[model samples]
Target: MPGRLLWTLAAVMLAAGLVAVGLGLRGPAGPPQPPAWAATARPVAHHAPVMARSVPVRVDVPSLGVRAPLVRLGLEPDGSVQVPAADRPGEAGWYDGGPTPGERGPAVLLGHVDSAKGAAVFYELGRLRPGHRIEVGRADGRVAVFTVESVERVPKDRFPTRRMYGPIGHAGLRLVTCGGSFDKDRRSYQDNIIVYASQTAVR
Candidate 1:
């Protein structure tokens, strides 16, 4: 119910924006489409070997009240990270581009705020406030707790890469998800709201 509460508010904002956009685009006649080009299959290039490290076993955030299992997955063909299922779904894996959680770098955890079917694990993540706690349990029998320092919503197009992936003085964590108004045509949220937390206590 806590997760749904936040999602409902987001949905309302999306609905209102859609109505306004629909009213504004009343008279629109677009140009005709160009001829389609022949589709050609390109050879897939070999990539460097993935660092087959074990995935974090679980995540616990007492402040926002979350404790759930986590799973690791590779990137999809479209370059977007896969979203874990909402009901009894595993945690969405980290983007290989970033550091692993608990390592001496910035680790990222992404999830769907809410899928088409229902509330996702991170539906209430946007509600987290500064000074909250986020604990990540690793398969190595170690747990990392990060203290929330800040939370901000940034446009997807203008996501602060340096801030998210840049070097931090110490181990850090970032929680990301699609937020802001949902565009029906795009079928995706317009912006990404990220919560930045850093290691405060580890056990």
Candidate 2:
């Protein structure tokens, strides 16, 4: 219910052009700072290394019951990350400017918490727990299996740019959606829910 309450209001603003697409990807000024917990958070740990050069086709999070097709998203004219079409809020968008899932960096997957009508793809994203598995199917026929490390609820104004979109020593994943409470006057969610995960397996 909290997710829905925050998601719908943000969705309404996103539909109305009040909220920027992939608002958390880029800050108005500079690069993002890695979250405080980054040092303790282990990268996706596994045996041999695999090069992730393929594009993502879909993302499946069994714990949250999420399986959504992926769309390639680029930056806007002002250099902000682009999001899926507002009309199609259920879709998830992969940031093409960054490494693909299973790659040696933080691959971004963004979705609307809710749509204009109701709950969207990532409505229950905040419910995911550490160690949850997130499977991302790639265009190259491999599934990048990631293990969740942590989840944080941060204010939109203080989104960690470096910790989130920054380069990592190993394959990583970031699942982002609007969270916190909705501000009626602002017509948007005041916080963001970010899931931090690491690539642990490939198949």
Best model per TM-score: 2
Q: What C-alpha lDDT values do all the predictions have?
A: 0.56, 0.71
Candidate 1 colliding pairs? none
Across 60-153, the per-residue lDDT of candidate 1 in tens digits comes to: 8786566777776444454444445444433544655556676766787766555434555666666776666788887777777777777766
lDDT of candidate 1 at residue 37, scale 0 to 100: 23
TM-score of 1: 0.68
In model 2, the Cα lDDT at residue 185 comes to 57
Would you estimate the TM-scores of all the predictions? 0.68, 0.79
Model 2: residues with Cα > 4 Å off, grouped in runs: 1-44
Compared with the true structure, the alpha-carbon lDDT of candidate 2 equals 0.71
- CA displacement after TM-score superposition, residue 48 of candidate 1 (Å): 32
lDDT of 2 by residue, 1-203 (tens): 24564344334323323343333322232122224453245544555265649999999999778889999987665545677776786699898877899888888888876656566777777777677899999998989888988877777776676677655688889988776656655656677778898888878
Ten consecutive residues with minimal summed lDDT in candidate 1?
Answer: 30-39
In angstroms, the error of model 2 at 4 is: 38
* Backbone clash count, each prediction separately: 0, 7
The local lDDT score (0 to 100) that residue 141 gets in candidate 1 is 79
